[model samples]
Every structure is written in structure tokens, then in C-alpha cells.
Target chain A: MRRYLRIWRIFFTHSLIQDLEYRLNWWLNAFNTLLFLGSSALVLWVVFTQADAIGGWTFDQALTLLGVYLLIEGVTVVFLVPNLNRVPQYVRKGELDYLLLKPIAARFIVSTRYASVWWVPQLGLALAVILVGMARQGTLTAGHLGLLALMLVAAIGTLYAVWFALTTTAFWFVKVDNVSELFTAFFAAGRFPVSAYPGWVRALLTFVVPVAFLTTVPAEAAAGTLTWGWALAAVGVAALLLALSQALWRYALANYTSASS
Target chain B: MRWRPRASLGDVIRVDGLRKVYRVHEKEAGLRGSIRAFVDRRYRDVVAVDDVTFGVAPGEVVGFLGPNGAGKTTTLKVLSGLLHPSGGTVRVAGFEPRRREGAFLRGITLVMGQKQQLSWDLAAVDSFLVNQAVYEIPDAVYRERLGELTEMLSLDGLLRKQVRKLSLGERMKCELAAALLHRPDVLFLDEPTIGLDVTMQQQVRRFVADYNARHGATVVLTSHYMADVTALARRILVIDHGRLVFDGDLSALVEARAPEKRLRLSLSERVDRADLAALGRVHAAEGLEIELGVPRADVARVAAAALARLPVVDVAIEDVPVEDIVADLFAQGRAARAADAVRAAHEAGAAAGGRG
Candidate 1:
């Protein structure tokens, strides 16, 4: 495990250096990330102006939920998206052969290979938003902060497992480039409170795709509204999905015929 | 560096009845076929490797020669644990390749000429560091190995340059360095010198030979460039139609497939084409130059006859090239298969006639 972490660290450092090499592109990417967050915040401001409360939450609560969404998006962009997006290409080009030959697990290598450290600033922006929203709501307590941190970790784990499982299908369906787009489409629903959606849509977001756990439940923890049952369920779901995704990754690898065969 | 296999071991790599069949989707080439395929998909099984078996002794460099789709890459992939074999078994360095244990991976590396393991945007050294961590090499060993590899491949400034910015040959050298950072005892190189200039090709060939000589590593290389095979591999394995058609020393393969040498004579005067033919099989005849294909056993007699008959100024006897010999070997394999089919048909006809 330590060896794998060391490998990930090396890969991450390489990505950081590579990103820094393109100074102009690096700044441009940073600008674009801020532009995206600014635009999203603008949308949130307009929505709150139109209504005082969204789905039983005040303006600060909705902003906190948006912050959670941004945080998850930042993590996904930093680690999961960049790596998973390359799976189809790797499968088509047979470049995955090198990963398979490595002494470490292929999944671990592929998932952590090309981290987008350029997104680090975006993650910092998300943290700023979360802190500001918490400060505005006057809900910044130690207990709430601890719970929020735990739920955030669980959410990130669940999100990574979901992305991994989706990308693992690339071994069989080599042209599944749109799979991440599908995830993004569902993730957009997490920008608002899960309670804002109708019953069936809420259930779909909560259980089927679990975008609620990624955003709304973590936001609830931040708001000091999360129940013990839901927090326990979040941890259990994260563990279950992680194991499932790992198993699926193995099964997909077994079916890998490798390119040029 | 930690564990060296005894040199007296019979074979570092062994295979038995290995086979890999790929199920490829077969789609017809039209709008109608595409529409129909959307509703019902069809697949065809391609036999990439068929009951192929070969072995390589310790410290030996074996060349794998095959036409495209003849299973050279597939066999290498299977042997390197990239793809699982559909049938039979493969053992490399006394470990089943499919198992892909840490020790097994630590002992072997596969380099594909068309594919690269280096990170495109980073310096080659960064990728090397990644490999260092993946292979779990000690810091001291990693630095020592990197220093030696840098010196050997002349990768002084190249390590700091981004891989995408490097020249093809430079990138290839770095690829070799990255794959060798662990100093694996077994190397599987598939077209390691493809798309290289003659100089770079020679350099790569020399590097492979030098690395093998230094480390006593068992190397299996596949290449379209016979120069690579001739310069590095003494024993060549030729695969045709997913089967090992020829496996022997380079000279032995040449002798088996083409048991004749070319006798080129720059005659003092123009010699008749018929006279050249009478001497041996006339390969080419120009104004004052004559070339004859003489049987290996009759080379002396043919040369003596040629000198006695024609006014020969200079004579030279050269063996057939390894490329032509391999092409002829493939042709012979095809002819033999065709003959077998014909014989089978004739026997079936005879049996049916006898029953009738």
C-alpha cells in the first residue's frame, strides 16, 4: 500500500511539473476554472433572488450544497475524470499493456496516472465557498465540521468508485467516451437540494446514481441536519461501491483482449 | 541484481500449445448492414496464435519473424502477461506469465516500438521515476541504474526534455531506458527498431546486444527489419499462419529454405546468357556482368566450369539474404498447407469411390 502511494505521489508530481511547464496554459486553465465557478455562483445568486428558500433550505443552505457540488466536481476533475477519460484511448491503442505489466495493480496505476494538478486551485476555490457559506449560516461548529469532513471523504470515495466502474466498461465497449458525460449530466442534479426534486427523481438521485450522497448528504452534514442513519448508510454505500467497482475492474481486465490481437 | 538464475538452466522462457483466439466484431460495409448490425451483432473468431510453442535458453536472443496478423505481437503479449492465453501454458523465468506476480513482473519488461510508456508531457526522467516507484527499486539502486543507462544510451540531456518534444529515436531510447530501469532479466521487444533510420537502428541493435551481453538477459525480439534480427539474434523463429514455420539458427534457416548461393562474375568480355545458364541457373546477365544461382553443393563445380568456359575477371559467391530466405520459407509453408489440403481431398475422394 505504501508502495502504491509512493507511485501515485511520483505520478502526481510528474503531472504537476508537466502542468507547470505550460505556463500560459496553466494560467489559462486556472482562469477558466474560476470563470466556471463564478458563473455557477452567479446562477445561484439569481436563483436565490427569485426565491427565499429552495426545498426547505434557506439561501445559505443552497449555497452550501452548491459548494459541496463544486468540491466533488473539483476532486473528480483532479483525479478521477482525467484518468478515466484515458481508458478508452488506452484500450484502443493497447497502451494499457504497459500498465498491466507493472508490478502494481493496473487499476491503481490507471486511476492515479495522470492527475490534473491544474485543478488544485479550483478545489481551493470550492473550499473557500464552503467556508463562506458555513460562516454566513452561523453553523460553523466543531461537531458539524467533523461530520462534514467525514461525509466529504465518503462522498469522494463513492464518486471515485462510480467513475471507475463506468470507465471499466471501456474494456468491453471501447468507444464509451460519452460515459463521463453521462456522469456529469447526473451530477448536475446535485447542484440543488435532493428534496427539491419530486419523489421518484429524488429516489433516483439518492439510491440509483447516488448523486445525493455526493452533494446533498454532505451538504446536510455541513448544515448539521444529517441523521445518524444516513451517515452510516453513506459510509456503507461507499465501501460497497468501492468493492463492487474493484471487482468489476478485475472482471473487465479479464475480458481485455488487448489491441493488435 | 538481487536474484540471478543459474546459467545452466535449460530455458528461461517456455511455452506449450499456446493459443489465443480473438472474437472480433464483423460488420458488413453498407448502410443496410449497419442498420441490421444495430439490431443483431455478429462476431468472428480470429485465431491469432494457434498451438504455437517455442523456448528460449538463458542469455539467448531469439528473433520472432512473422507477417502481420501472424501472431508475433499476440504471442509476446501473452508471454508478457498483457493478454491471457486461450489455451495451453506459458512460463517465463519459472513463473506463469498470466499470474503476473511482483517477482515475475520485476524480472521482465516488454517494449513495443509503436507504443510508448513514457508520459507524453513530462520529461523522460519523470516517467522513469514512476517506474522506479512501481518496481519498488531502492533509491541507491535506482540512481546507479539510471546513471549507467544514461551513459550507455547517451541520454545526458534527453532525460529532461519532454517526451513529446524529443525526436523519434530519442523517445525510443528513453522508452528502452524506462523499460530497463528495473534491469529485468527477460526482455520482450516487439519491433524495437521500427521507423528508425539505419544509424539509429544499428544503435538500438547494438544496445540490445550490449545489454544482453552485460546482463545475460534473455531477449525475444520481433522485427520486420532483418538487419535487426541478423545483428542481434542468432536463432530465429518464423511464424506463418499462426504456427511456427521455421525455428533454427539464421544460417540454418537460410540453408533450409534457400540451399543456393549467388555467383556474381564480372566477365572480361560479354558472356552469352545461354552460357551463363549452362554454368548454373542464370539469375541476371548484363553486358559484362553475369549472376548465377548455384546449388550450395555444386558451387565449386559451377565456379570451375564458369572459369573454364567464360572469360571471368572477378568472381564472388554470396549467400542468400535472410529476408529472401524468410519470404521463401513463408511461401513454402503456404505451399505445404495447400498440398496437405489437396491430399486430404484426394484421400476422401478415393475412400468415397471405394465405398461406392
Candidate 2:
């Protein structure tokens, strides 16, 4: 475990350095994230303008949920998409050969091989938004903070699990741009809390794509209203997805035909 | 019949009847074809490696010389476990490569000059560090190995530059260093000095020779450059159309596959092409000079006949150039493949009682 952690650190730092290689790129990405975040907040503002609350979520609770969505987005963009999204390209170009040759797990290397630092500004802004919402509510506690951290792990794990499983399928399909795009559209549903939608839509958000685990659970934890049942469900879903994805990745490796060189 | 390096008991590498067939999707031109392909794709099986078998003893540097798409790279990939063969068995460093066990991975390294393992936007050293961590090398040992490679590869000033910014030769040197940091017992280098300046190629050649000598690592290298093979490997494997056509000592290859010898005669006068054609294939007829392409076994007989009959003043016999022989070897392989196709077609016609 320690060895894997050490290798991950090495990969992480180098990837960050690579992302910073172009000075303008870092600034541009940061600016792009902030603009997207601003547009998202505007949508929230317009939603609240029509009514005091939607589906029982207070303005503060909804704001915290949006912040959680942004936080997860920044984390995945920085650490997950750059790697998982390129699995097809790696398989196409035969780069997976070198990765597979490594003594460690190829999945581990591919997952942690790159991480961008451009998400820093977006993550900082997200933290500010979440804290502001919590301050307005004045109900956050040490226990609640601990629960939020746990929820954050579960959220990131769930996100990585689904993306990795879908991406690993590229080994067989080799192209799934439209499918992934549709997934992105589904993920964008997280910007609003599950409570904001009707019963069926909430079910889709909570169970089908699990945008609820990504945002609502963490947001609820930050809001100090997360129930034991929801937290258990979130953790269970994350673990199950992780196990399934890892198995798929291994099966894909065994069937991997290195691109004709 | 073709020669195969016999597989010994303790050989570091052994391959027997190895084959790989690629299933390629075929599509026709035009929108109609595209839509048809979407509904029902046509597939073809390309035999990339066909019944190739060879073995390498520990510490032997073997050259895999073949024409493009002749299965040298494919065979290398199969040996390294990056690919699974469609038929037969292979054992590299005492492990079945397709399994890619940790011990097997740790025992071998593959370097392809056309591709890179380094991060494009990061310094070469960063990639090395990643390799170091992943390979689980102790810090002190990693430093010592890096220091040695730095000196031997003249990698002193090259490690810190971004991989994309480095010159090809510099990047190649760094690649060699990165690949060898783990001190693998076997090395698979596919065109390690391709596309470099002659001087750099020589340097790479020298480094590979040195590495093999120092560490006693078994090496399997492939290149179009005969000079690369001649300088580094004593034994050469000539593969064509996914089959091992020739495998033996360098001198033995020259002795066996060379098409013909040149018989040069300084005659008292220019001989008629007719007269020389009777003796052998007429190559050239100049003033008081004649050259004939005499079969290797008939060089002496043809020379003696020329000396006895023609107004011959001087005579000499020379072997055909090695380069021409190599080119002819590939031509022969192509001709053989064509002949096989023709024979197959004839048998098919005979069975079907002729068509067209």
C-alpha cells in the first residue's frame, strides 16, 4: 500500500508539472472554470427568483449543493477525465503496451499518471461557496465536517468508478464520444439538489446516474442533515461500483490486443 | 526448409511455431458502402507472424533483420508479452510473456525508437523517477544506476529537457537510460537508432554493445540499417512475410543466400555477348574486359573455361555484394509467396474443373 502511495505521489507531481508547462494554459483553464461556475450560479439565482424554495430545499441548502457539484466537477476534471477519457486513445496508439509492462497495475498508473493544477481556483471558489452557505445556516459541527469528508470520498469514488468502467469499455468499442457526452449531460443534473426534482426525477438522480451521491449527500453532510440511510447507500454504491469497474478493467487487460505497431 | 536457432534447455528466450493473425475490418468507398459497413462489417485475417520459431541463449545479441511489415516488430511484441500470439508457445526470461507476471516484467525491457514512454511536457528525469518508483528500486541503487547510465549514454545535459524539446538522438539516449534503469536481464529494442544521424547511430550502437557486454543482457534488436546489425550482432535472423527465412552466423548468411558471384576477365579483346552467355549470364562487355554472373558453384568451372577458350589475359572471381544479396533475398521471398498463391489457385481450378 505504501509503495502504491509513493508511486502515486510521483505520478501526481509530475502530471501537475506537465499541466503547468504552458503558462497560459493554466490561467486559461482557471478562467474557463470560473466562467462556467458563474453561469451555474446564475441558473440557481433564476430558479430561486421564481419561488422561495423548490421541492423543500432552502436557498442556502441549494447553494451548498451547487457548491458540492462544482467541487466534484473540479476534482474529476483535474484528476479523472484527463486520464480515463484518454483510455481509447492510449489503446489506439498502443501506448497501453508500455503501461501494461510496468510492474505495478496498469490501471493504477493510468489513473494517477496525470493531474492538472488548473482546478485550484475553481476548488477554492467552491469551498468559499460551501462555507458561506454553512455560515448562513450556522449549524456545521466537527462531526458534520468529518461526515462531509467521508461523503467527499464516497462521491469521488463513485464518480471515478462509473467513468472508469465506461471508459474501459473503449478497449472493445474504441469509440464512444456521443455516449460519454450524454453522460456529461446527465452529470450536469447534479447542479441542483435531488430534493429540487419530482419523485421520479429524484429517483433517476439518486439511483440511475447517482448524481445524488456526488452532490446531494455531500451537500447534506455540509448542511448537517445527512441521514444514516442515505450515507450508507452512498458508501455501498461507491464500493460496488469500484469492485465492478476494477473487474472490468482486468478483463479488458486480458483481452487487450496491443494496437498493431 | 529454413534454419531455426535450436532451443536449448536454459535459453533465455524460446519461441516455437509462434503465429499471430490480425483481423482487420474492411470498408469500401462511398456513402453506400459506409452505411453497408455499419450494418455488416467485412473482416479479413492478415497473418502478421506465421510459424516463426527461434531461440536466444543468455547474453546473446541477435539481430532481427526484415523488410517492413515482415513481422519483426510483431514478433518482438509477442516476445515481450504486449501481444498474444494466435498459435504456438513462447517463453521469455523463463516466463510465458502473455501472462505478464511481475517477475517476467522485472526481468525484461522493450525500447521502440518510433515511440516514447516519457511524458512529452515533462523533463526526461521525471519519467525516470516514475519508473524508479514503479519498479520499486531502492533509492541508493536507483541513483547508482542512473549515474552509470548518465556517463555511458552521455546523458549529462539531456535529462532535464522536456522530452518533446529534445533532439531525436538526445531523446533516444534518454530512452535507453530510462529503459535500462531497472537493469533488466533481457532487452528488446525495435529500431533503437532509427532516423538518427550516422554519428549518433554509431554512438547508440556502441552503447548497446557496451551495455550487453557489461550486464550480459540478452538482446533482440530489429533495424533496416545493415550497419546497425553488422556492428552489434554476430547472428542475424532474416524474416520475410512473417516467416523466418534465414537464421545463422553473419558469415553463414552471406555464404548461403548470396544469389551469384561475379567472374571478371580481362580478355585479349572484347568478347561477344553470345560467347559469354554460353559461359554464364553476361554482366558487362567493355574493351578487353568482360564480367559474367556465374553461379557460386560454377565460378571455378566458368573461369577455367574462359581461360582455356577466350584470349584471356587475366581473370578474377568476386562474391556479389552483401547489399545486393539482401535485396535479392527479399525478392526471392516475394517470388516464393507468389508461386504459392499461383499453385493454390491452380489446385482450386483443378478441383472446380476450371473457370475463366
Candidate 3:
């Protein structure tokens, strides 16, 4: 485990240096991220002004949910999405040969080889938004904050596992570049509370794609309304999905015929 | 060079009846064909490697020689554990390559000419460090090996530059350094000298030779350039149509396929083509020079006769080139396949006659 962590450290440092080389790109990406956050916040503000609550949640609650969505998006774009998106290209171009020859796990090398540093500022922005919502609600407690942290970690794990399982399919189907786009589209629903949708849509979000675990559960924890049952279920679901993703990755690797065979 | 006895050496790589079949999708050209393909897709099985069997000693440098689509790369892939074989067994370093155990992966490295493992946006040294971490090399060992590889490959200033900023030769050298940082026992190189200039090709060839000599690594190289094979490999494996056609010493291959020598004569005066033809098969004749293909047993006699009977000013004798020998071998393989087809047809006809 320490060795894997060291490898990740080296990879992250390399990415940081590469990212620093293009100073203009860093500024542009940061500006774009801010613009996206601002637009989403504007939409939330406009909706909350028209009604006290759209789905039995107040303005502060909705703001906290939006913050959760941005935080998860920040993590995905920074670490998981860029690397996972390259899996199909590697398979198609036969570049995976290099990865396969490494002494480490091929899946670990491919998934964590790149981490985009430019998107990290969005994560900071997400923390600011979440804090602002908590300040507005005047509900600051040590126990609630601790629970929110645990729930946030579980949420991120669930998201990572889901994304990983989807991208691992690229080993078998080389043309699945659009799979991540499907994830993004489904994840957009997390911008609102799962309760806002109908009963069936809520169940789909909770079980099928599990976007509710990513946003609603964590947001509820921050709002001090998360039940013990939901928190335990979220942790259990995250563990199960993580194991499932690992098995799926192994199966996909075994099915890899390699290009130019 | 003379052929040496290889039976005394212990084989580190043993492959038996290895086969790899690929399922490739087939689609036609026209709109109708496209629609038909969409409605009813067809996939054909391509036998990339067929019942090929060979073995390599612990320190042997073997050249895999073949034309395009002759399955040289496929064989290397199977041996390196990149592609699983459809049938048969392969053992490298006393482990099944397909299993890809950590010990197996650590003991071998595969370098493809067209593919790169360096981080393109970072300095080559950074990529080397990444490899150091991946292979879990100790800091002291990593520094020592990096120093050795850098000096051997003349990669002092190039390691600090971004990989994208380096020239092709420079990048190739760095690629070699990165691949060898761990000092793997077995090296699988596929067209490692492709697209390089003559000088660069020679540099890479010399590097491979020195590295192999210094480390005693088992090297299996696939290349179209005969110079690469001739300079480095003494034993050559010739593959054609997914089959191993020839596997033996380089000199033995030349002797079996082309039992002749080339004699070039610079005459004092122009001679008749018929007079030159009487001595040997005239390959080419210019104003005052003639090239002859003489059998190996009669080369000395022919040279003496030409000097005594003709106004020869200069004469040179040389063995047949490896390129010509390989081309002839490929041609012979084609002919043998054709003959086998005809014989099979005749047998079938006879069987049909008996049935009637």
C-alpha cells in the first residue's frame, strides 16, 4: 500500500510540473471552472427566489446540495475522468502494451497515472459554498461535521467505483469513448435533491446509477438531517461497488485481445 | 562467422505449438455493403501465429526475420505476455507468460518501435523516475543504473528536455534507457530501429549488443532491416504465413538457401557477355565490370579461369548477402506451399476416382 501511494505521489508530482509549464492554461481552466460554478449558483438562486422550497428543502439546503455536486465533480475531473478517458485510446492504439508490461497492476497504473491539477481550485470553491450554506442555516456542530466528512469520503468512493466500472468496459469495447459522457449526463441530475424527482426517478438515481449517494446523502449529512440507516447503507453500497468494480476490471483485462493481434 | 553449437546451452524461453487466432470484423466498401454489414455483421478468424515452436537460450540473441504480416510481431507479443495465445504453451523465465506474475513481469521488458512509455509533457528524467518507482528500485540502485544507462546511451543533456522536444534518435535512446532501467533479463524488441537514419540505426544496434554483452540478457528482436539482424543476431528465425520456416545459424541459412558466392570482376577491357556467361551466371555487366553468381564449390576455379583466360584487372569474392538469402528463402516457401496444394488436389482426385 505504501508503494502504491509512493507511485501515486510521483505521478501527481509529474502532472503538477507538466501543468505548471503552461501557466496560461492553468488560468484559463480556473476561469472556466469559476464560470461554470457561477452559472450553476445563479440558476439555484433564481429557482429559490421563485419558491421557498422546490422539494421540501430551503434555499440553504439547496445551496449545500449544489456544493456537494461541485465538490464531487471537482474530484472526478481532477483525478478519475482524465485518466479513465484515455483507456479506450490506449486499447485502440496498442499503447496498453507498455502498461501491461509494468510490474504493477495494469488497472491501477492506467487509472491513477494522471491527475489534473488545474481543476483543484474548484474543490476549494466547493468548500466555500458549503460553508456559506452552513453559516446561513446557523447549524454548526462537531458531530454533524464529523459525520459529513465520513459520508463525503464514502460518496467519493462510490463515484470513483462507478466511473471505474464503466470505463473498464473499454478494454472489451474499444469504441466506448462516449461512456463517460453518459456518466456526466446522469450525474447532472445530482444537482437537485433526489426527492425533487418522482418516486421512480428517485429510485433510479438511488440504485441504478447511484447519483443520490454522491450528492443527496452527503448534502443531508451537512444539513444535519441524515438518518443513521441511510449513512450505513451508503457505506455498505460504496464497499460493494468498489469490490464489484475491481472484479469487473479483472474480467475486462482477461478479455483484452490487444490491438494488432 | 561460423555456426556454433547451441545444444549445450540451457533454454530459458520454451514455446511449443503456440497459436494465436484473431477475430476481425469484415465490412465492404459500398453503401449497400455498409447497410448489409450493419444488418448482418461478419467476423473472420485470422491465424496470426500457427503451431510455431522455438526456444531461446539464457543469453542468446535471436533475430525474428519476416515480411509484413508474417507473424513476427505476433510471436513476440505472445512471448512477452501481451497477447494470450489461442493454443499451446509458452514459458519465459520458468513462468507462464500469460499469467503475467510480478516476477515474470519484472524479469522481462518489451519495447515496440512505434510505441512510447515516456511522459511526453515532462522531462525524460521524470519519466525515468516514474519507472524507478513502478519497478520499486532502491534509490542507490536507481541512481547507479541511471548513471550507467545515461553514459552508455550518451543521454546527458537529453534527459532534462521534454520528450516531445527531443529528436527521433534522441527520443529512441531515452526510450531504451527507460525500458532498461530495471535491467530485465529478457528483452523483446519489435522493429526497434525503424524510421531511424543509418547512423542512428547503427548506434541502436551497437547499444543493444553492448547491453546484452554486459548483462547477458536474452534478446529477441523482430526487424525488416537485414543489417540489424546481421550485426546483432547469429541465430535467425524466419517466419512466413504464420509459420516458422527456418530456425538455425545465420551462416547455415545462407548455405542452405544460397549455396553460392558473388564474384565481381573489373576487366582491363570490355568482354563479351557470352564469354562471361561461359564462366558463370552473369548477374550484371557494365562497360568494364562484370558480376557473376558462381557456385560455392567452383568459386576458386572460376576466379582462376577468369584471371587466366580474360583480361581481368581486378577481382573480388564475397558471400551472398543476408537480404538475398532471406528473399530466396521466402520465395522457396511460396513454391513449396504451391506444390503442396497441387499434391493435395491430385490425392483428392484419386480418392474421388476410387469412390466412383
Candidate 4:
């Protein structure tokens, strides 16, 4: 465990040094975060102008849900997206063998290899947005913080599991970027709470796209109305997905043909 | 069919009946076939690295020679644990390579000429640092090895430069440094000097030799350049059509595959093709220069006869080139392989009929 951590730390430093070579990314990412926030805020204002409440949740509740969505997006963009998406290129180019030959686990090497640190500012702002929403609802209980912590873990783990499971399919279909893009489109639904959508859309988001576990659970945790049952269920489903992805990764390695030299 | 007995005690690497089969998706040549194939995908087994068995004792350097797609790279991959074998077992440094245990991986390294492990966007130094951590090299040891490699590979300025920005030779030098940072006991280098300038190739050769001498590391290398094999390897293993066709000393391989010597003669006058052929098999004849291939046993008689009959100004006898010998080995295998396939088909038919 310590050895893997050391490798991740080294990778983090390597990424920082590499990012320094492209100094313009800081400004570009800042601009990108603002663009995302502006569009989401515009949609929220447009939706609330028509309805006073969205599926029984007031405007502040929906705002917090959007904030949670952005938070997940920020974390994914920072660490997971850039790295997971490169799995296909590595498989196609046969560069994964180098990673496989490493002393550490290949999954660990690929997962934590790249980081876009420029998104840290937006991550902080997303946290502030969640806190502000909680304050407005006057739900500042210690129990709420504990529930939020557990839900956040489940949310992040589930996101990684889905993305990684999709990415690992590259071993069989070397070009699945189109399917990954579809997953991204589904992830956009996380910007709105599942309850705001109709019943069928709620089921699709909860089961098919997993946006509910990603956004709604954490938003409910911040809402102080979250139940222990919901938190445990999210954690259970996330654990199952993580184990499946890990098993798939192992099976993929065993059958890897390693693109000919 | 095995020549050398398996070295069970002292060998750093061992393989017994190693085989790897690839189920390649067959693609069709036309639109109709492509659609049919897409509708119902079919695959065929490609037996790469078929029943190959070999061993390398501690600190031994063996040159693996084979034609393109003759399974040299596949065997190397299996040895390095990148590809698991369909049949047989491989052990390197007393551990199974397929398991790829941390200790086993730390004990071996594979360097492919066309591929690199360096982070392209970062300086080479950053990738080296990554390797250091991944390999769990102590800080003091990492610094010591870095200094040694930087000096050996002439990587003083190259370390800080982005891998993408460096020249091919420069990148290769840094790559070698990265691969050797862990100082693995078993090194599997496939075409390590490919696409390098002559000077760079020579430097790489010398660096490999020096590293081997200092650390006594086992090296298995494959290259198109016979000079590399001749200069470094004491023994050579030749693979053709996914089989080990020849395994012995380099001199023995040349002597066994080529039973003739090259005789180059410069005559006082232009000679007839018939007269040159009379001396021996005419390899080349232009104006006053005539090259002949005479039986190794008859070289003395052929030289004596040529001197007495022709106005010989100069004559030199030499061994056939290793490249020609290896090429001839592969060429011979192609013909023999067709006959073997036919015989195997006949045997299969006969067995089926008998069973019926």
C-alpha cells in the first residue's frame, strides 16, 4: 500500500512538472469552469422562472444538486477523465505493456497517472456552494456532515467504477470513444436531481446512467433529509460495481494479446 | 528435438515447450465479406511461439535471430510477462514470469526499439523519477544509478529535454537509461538499436557490453543487424516459422548453415562466365573481379586450379556473411515447411480414416 502511494505521489509530481510545460492550461481551465457554471446557472434560472419548485425541492435544493454535479465533474476532470480516456490509445498503440511490466499494479498506475490540477479552484467553489445551500436550509447538523461524507465516497467510487468499466472494454473494442461520449451525455442529467425528472427518467438515471447515486444522494445528504438506507444502498452498489470493474480488468490482462511489435 | 538439456540449477531464465496462440479476427478483402464478418465475427488461431524451449545461464547473452514475424518478439514478450503462454511455463530469476510478481517484475525488463516508456510531454528526468518510485529504488541508489547512466548514455543535457522534442537517438538513449534504472538481472531487448545512426548503435552496443560486464545481467536480444549479434553474443538461437531451427555458437551456425567459402579473385583480364563457373559456383563476375562460392573442403584445390589456369592478380578467401547465412536458413525453412504441412495433412487424413 505504501509503495503504491509512493508511485502515485511520483506520478502527481510528474504531472505537475509536465503541466508546467503547458502554462496556458490554468487560464483555459478557469475559463472552462466559468463556462460550465454560467450555462448551468442559466438553465436553473430559466427552469425556476417557470415553476416555483422542481418535484417538491425548492430552488436552493436544486442549486445544491447542480453544485454536487459540478463537484463530481471537477474531480473526474482533474484525475479520472484524462487518464481513463487514454486507455484506448495505449491499448491501440501497445504501450500498455510497459505499464503492465511495472512492479506496481497496472490499474493503480493508469488510474492515478495524470491529474489536471487547474480544476482545484472550481472544486473549492463547488464545496462552498454546497455549504451555502445547507446554510440556507439551516441543516448544519453533525450527523448531516457524516452522511454527506459517506455519500460522497459512494458517489466518487461509483463514478470511477462506471468510467473504468466502460474504459476497460477497450481491450475488446479498441475504439469505444463514441460509447464513452454517450456516457458523458447521460452524466449531464446529474446536473438536475432525479426527483425533478419523471418517474421513468428517475429509474433510468438511477439504474442505467447512475446519475442518482452520483449527484442525488450527495445532494440529499447536504439537504439533511438523507436516510441511512439511501446512503448504505449507494455504498453497496458502488462497492459491487468497483469489484466487477476490478475483476474485468484482471480478466482483460490475462487475455491481452499485446499489439504486435 | 531439443538440443541442449534444460539447465535447472544455475540458469537465470528457463522455458519449456513455451507456446502462445493468438485468436486473430479475420478480415475479408471485399465489402460483402466485411459485412458478413461484422455480422458474425470469426477468428483463427495463429500459433506464435510454438513449443519453444531455451534457457540462459546467469550473465549469459544470447542472440535471438529470426525473420520478420517468426515469433522472436512473441517469445520475448512471454519471457517478460507481457503475454501469457497458451502452453508451457517460463521462469525468470526463479519466479514464474506469467504471475508477474513484484519481485519478478523488478528482476526483469524488456526494451522494444519502436516503443518507449518515457512520458512524451515531460522531461526525460521526470519519467526516470517515476521509474525510480515504481521500482522502489532508494533515493541514494537512485541518484547513484542516475549518475552512472547519465554518464554512460551521455544524457547530461538530454535528461531535462522533453521526450517529444528529442531526436530519435537521444530518446533511445534516455529510454535505455530508464529501463536500466532498476538494474534488472534479466534484460529482454528486441531490436534495441533499430532506427539509430551507426555511431549510436555502436555506443549502445558498448554500453550493453559494459553494463553486462559490471552487473553480470542476462540479456536476450534480437536485431536485424547481424553485427550486433556477432559482436555481443557468444551463442545464437535462430527461429523460423515459430520454431527453433538452430541453436549453437555463432561460428557453428555459420559453419553448419554455410558449407562453402567465398573466394574473390581479380584476374588480369576479363574472364568468361563459364570459366569462372568452372572454378566454383559463380556468385558475381564483372570485368576483372570474380567472386565464387567453393565447397569449404575443396577450397584449396579450387584456389590451386584457379591460380594455374587463370591469370590471377589477387585472390582472397573468406567466410560467408552471417546475414547471408541467416537469410539462407529462413529461405530453406520456407520450402521445408510446405513439405512438412503436406505430410502432416496426410498423417491427419490417415489417422481419421483408421479411426473410422
Which sequence of candidate numbers ranks them by DockQ, best first? 3, 1, 4, 2
- Candidate 2, residue B300: how far the Cα is off, in Å: 9.3
- Residue-wise C-alpha lDDT for candidate 2, range A15-132, written one tens digit per residue: 6676666789878877887788788778878988998987778888888888888889888877887787788889888888888888888888888887777676788888888888
Candidate 1 docking category? medium
Model 1: per-residue Cα lDDT over A31-90, one tens digit each: 997898788879878888998888898888888887888889989988888899999899
Q: Which run of 10 residues does model 1 chain A get worst, by summed lDDT?
A: A252-261
TM-score, one value per model: 0.93, 0.90, 0.95, 0.94
Give the lowest summed-lDDT range of ten residues in model 2 chain B. B1-10
Q: What lDDT tens digits, residue by residue, belong to model 2 across residues B255-344?
A: 777658999989777666788899999878787788889888888888888888899888888877666677888998889889999999
**lDDT tens digits by residue: candidate 1, B6-34:** 22348888888898888877788999999
Interface RMSD of each: 2.1, 1.8, 1.6, 2.3
Cα-based lDDT at residue B339, candidate 4: 93
DockQ of candidate 2 (2 decimals): 0.60
Best by lDDT: 3
Q: Model 3: what is its DockQ? A: 0.70
Candidate 3 ranges with C-alpha deviation above 4 Å: A258-260, B1-9, B267-270, B286-288, B311-313, B349-356
Q: What share of the true interface contacts does each candidate keep?
A: 0.85, 0.66, 0.75, 0.77
Candidate 2 accuracy as lDDT:
0.87
lDDT, model 4, position A169: 90
For all candidates in order, the CA lDDT equals: 0.87, 0.87, 0.90, 0.87
True contacts kept of 4: 0.77
Give a tens-digit lDDT track for model 4, residues A159-194: 999899999999888898886688789998888878
